[model samples]
Target: MDAFSEELMRSVEEDDQEKASVGCGPEIHLPWLSQHIQNTVSHGHKGINFAQTTSICLNFIQEALLKHQWQQASEFLQCYFQALEDFNSQKRQVALQNIWKLGSAILYHHPKSSVETFSAFADRMKNIGVQNYLKISLQHALYLLHKGMVEEAYRNLNQAESWRYGEMSASQEKLIKLIQAYRGLLDYYTWSKKRTELSKFDMDGFATSAATQDMHSYFRQASVNLHEIIKIPGVWDPFVKSYVEMLEFYGDQDGARQVLTDYAYDNNFPSNPNAHVYLYKFLKKEKAPEDKLISVLKILHQIVPSHKIMLEFHMLLRKSKKEEHHKLGLEVLFAVLDFSGCIENITAWRYFAKYLKQIMMEKHLDWVQEGWSSRKDWWPTFHFSYYLAKKNWKENKILALEKAFTSGILLGKGCKYFMYVSKQGHKVQEKSIKTMKKFVMKHNILDSKEL
Candidate 1:
């Protein structure tokens, strides 16, 4: 038995009779597991064959597990462990892939069993160095997060960061950043409601705002990504706060409030992003805001006092050291709401609205609705209420669409102002110009001139 051919030893050890699998052997290939047992199954000798092929057995099992072939994985596991008594350290290290797969399978497909499998993986990981293990660790962290294993995932992320030296590629770094972003953002009020951990991996790639805002940016479709990023556990709070301040400095009140209220609310809530989103669309339709969203939001305050964006702006400015933004906030709000949505930050919106209206009782800027009847280029988002309240929406829809386009053009132009907003659910830019043209034609206005 000791004198058996090396290849024969391999085959004999594996108990696989597919002689065709024979690497460099003199014998015909044997495929049937039973035949290997029969040919080499002399009772005493049978167990030795299984021992030598432990690596192969484990690999087969692991592949099955990764593929979600749970039934096959179970069978492979049975066979693999039966032969485990003889596997050496070298064989074990060589079989790490399978071990990782098993860990992943348990965590993702069979959560109740994951604790044990993950413990096993941990032991295996300790024996290994940080080379290939980092990737596995990162994946494990992501899975743990998904399974609501927050602390474990946090520990793993720290460890993963340690391994993130100068060796990783840019793509790998980006992926790691995404993982951090994903893990950080899960702490938002919305996601925490279920007490479920967010996935660490960006399976949908929504974590880091892309280099260029795609169809899913917060800037384009405010509410969704806004909601997504604020909850993550990373340094999201500071990042969002700093970012909103920057938008405010840049005169992007709509942009800032989207961050403030929707993504991460500061104490002075800007109002839900919908207020900014809808009101901006109305102003933008009239070629308003004219590249300065801050000024645009101000005028919006003049015409529509109860506008949510201006309310948030008033809150932010109320604390301004310069007093410019604060005074401006009141002026704009007074002009826009016809004094409807007033609020004293030192007091609150309720008392302020009442006092402001009592102070200036001329009808709210109901006159701003004058030219809405002549609205020419509003399509795609023609909700029934839109046509019913044409003046209300004419400026909002046009400006909203323009800001959407400007954001894209700016990103493509590689402005210093890229990534100021999260871009989620932004299907405004179709990949195919032809498709957009066809859509435009289908929604042609009554006048060809409007087209």
Candidate 2:
């Protein structure tokens, strides 16, 4: 399994590299820009003069350079740079934006690039100004940290830190604080590294595990770090979910519940599904009574009427085998159908069909249609086919087979079973296995391989 997992990871990484390589290259948008320029000229627009034309042309050149189309970019700069450079201040600012944006793009998308590319980019940006240079350095450090080059990241970050006392905009300050918060989290994760009692293994190529020697101490430290970040303006609400996860990780059920319950009271609370899932898991761990479980599920269903919660509710009822629980499961299926069309989610329809079969078999039900039940489009056809084959084979074999085929439900293994049962030659039927065979072949529903 480990070997298979490693191979899968490598396959995924190769696929990512392939995608990144293809994505880094230029996309041709010159035709669109030409059309725009023609439209502006036709409109008799004087403001869209040579300077404006030069600006747009320079923008295109920047894009070409970013994509490593150096020859095309050079040609464009030679044509337009002289015209653009006539506006001294505006030209420098535009150049700065182009270089910075391209640097960010290359760092993010082109992972095959060496660290030396970053150093060269950093040196080029130094001519922009002191504050902007420091900002780029911090960003570079963060990128290094992401690549697991911790020592290099720290050194770069320290150098940036020494220059932090200089002038900075509000937005820049906020970004720096955000990076510091991430750095603190990284430091904690690094310090707490151990193999035992970790979170579940990651199948994806990113994080592998969250290991720690002391669970309690680790939770305390993580909580402190996260809370401080949370108090900062503009930090996302989802970060609070991590603090709740910490409690759950330590098996502190009551603590996790209290946090979720309190958070849910706020008017602006984010309808985070994971919070409800964790609460449900806590309820299960405590072995709460069935009523309490249902109550929690009701709240969960109310907030996020997702397929997952409904499926869990159905399974919980199926496990109990109580008549009321079965009825509740039926209602839950109706709710799911109402929320999502059967075509939108085939899996949910599949589950609903299984539940329908179970109820029909156990109760020998004769269902009557109300306004809602009249919607035959929402019916679980596969389950209906199975029910007909099981219950009415002797009474009306031909009709049963016809309904099953028309519904497009019994084409696979389901059809195989119907064939088996029909071959047994039960008493009270007008039709035989031979008739069913004709119907299957006539419609060409299943291939010979399927049979």
Top candidate when judged by TM-score against the true structure: 2
What's the residue-level lDDT of 346 in candidate 2?
A: 48
Provide backbone clash counts, one per model. 49, 0
Top lDDT prediction, candidate number: 2
TM-score of 2: 0.52
Tens digits of per-residue lDDT for model 2, 244-280: 6566666776766776555543446556555556567
Give the Å error, residue 267, model 2.
3.5
| Residue ranges of candidate 1 with Cα displaced over 4 Å | 1-95, 119-123, 126-129, 164-176, 186-451
Candidate 2, superposed: residue stretches over 4 Å from native: 1-55, 58-98, 107-112, 119-142, 151-177, 195-221, 231-254, 260-265, 286-309, 317-328, 331-350, 357-451
